[model samples]
Target: MLLLLCLSVLSQAAKAQETWEVFMEKIPEHLQVSLLIQDEEGQTLFSQSADKRIPSASIIKIPILIALMEKVENREITLDARYSLQATDKVGGAGELQHLPDGSGITFRYLAEEMIRISDNTATNILIRAIEMGYIQDWLKKNGYRDTQLNRLMMDFKAIEEGRQNYTSPREINDILLNLWEGKWLKEDSRAEIMHCLKGCADNSTIPSLLPAGTVVAHKTGTLDYVRGDAGIILGDKPLILSVFVENFESMEEAESAIGKIALKAFRDFGR
Candidate 1:
């Protein structure tokens, strides 16, 4: 058994080395990359600028989902509870809520699903209202995510212009997924519910684009004019918790392609 473990360690180290070389060679010069990958045992297989804070885009919704789940687990909120969408609630971005009629009532569960699955902007704002932003910020800080902050709601262009954007580090988000995968800080059922939401994510343009078909990846993706980020848990021979973020890209397609290549390298190396 000890010899087998030693072989596995050596294999992982070699894979990391190869992946590092690939990244250094292929990643474009215009973008900044932050990433972290961990095996099931919580050993970091690869990392680069993992501690740097960057704009979160819609990925900040993950923390919001976590806070909402905690509220549900504590009996402070009910998933079936409905909230009415005002004309003011509608915001433009990646979701169907903006197209829905005003005064339509949606349940917390449905809104949460939309937020993660489609990266819904309006659904996200409704959730922020349901579970106040203060609680979300407090939860992230109390949970040891020092670099993540929820400072503004989705589609708040004014806030963005004011420099009050949401932010998170690759390391912090990867750790969040690791905890969720292991059911460490949350009850198993709560963690399961969160994972269920994550699995519904529809944006397959980044990490999932290059992964083999039908790979079980429960993840969230965030995008902006110049930023792209994807983080998730990939179930394999040795489950991988991978986070990849690229910022300041000249184009989003290039950013996503870079992330896909990075994720594919890790998947091939560690998953095999």
Candidate 2:
């Protein structure tokens, strides 16, 4: 009985790999994509270029979020710690905080929530300053995220020009989500807080786009002129951890549609 079960699982994984390979081949030749899908048990169902590092865009926020939560868990910082917004802290892009006056004060909890919920650039920068970029980088390194880095602040065009862009890989992201799912590293309450914010993520055009309505997804999205990506856990009978990144794409619509198709396919194949 044990042998039969093992064979059955291997057969299913092989079939899923074939399906994903063929499906990926159908995407346009101009788009470069790296993808990985894993079951709740951290078993890889399908993968393609999973370790290839790609520009992370706002997806780098995931590491930032985790680092912040880790600090809170260690009592190095409190969520209620307040930050006074300064003109220099504001950045123009993907956040409401940019519109608020410089004197406005906000708490760490609010900044973290806004960072994930709305992909707020200003809120992210403030948190980065509060937590200190060195600590976040050290946390990521200590946690084994080799291909993920917080190299620059959000909306920093000058850094981009200097090639100091942030980056992450599909496999690393899947691992991050899997650890979160298993309650590794952080305490349960800290994990729950992160999930709550991710569940409220405003952007759903990628991984969750093709999933059924009200499908619970705790995810983050990243976008740049040449990059589009999403990574998250899909909650259901057969929960899945999916990470898909597309680079060098000419059309955002086409790239996102490709990502959606991949996610929907994973949902159906693994949910069985």
Best by lDDT: 2
lDDT of 2 by residue, 112-172 (tens): 9999988999999988987899998898899888899898999889998999989999999
Model 1: per-residue Cα lDDT at residue 254: 88
> What is the lDDT of every predicted structure here?
0.88, 0.90
lDDT per residue for candidate 1 within 87-198, as digits (tens), equals 9999997999999888898999999999999999999998998899999999999898888999999989999999898999989998888877787767988888898999
What candidate 1 gets wrong by more than 4 Å, as runs, is: 1-15
TM-score of each: 0.93, 0.95
Write down the TM-score for model 1.
Answer: 0.93
Top candidate on TM-score is 2
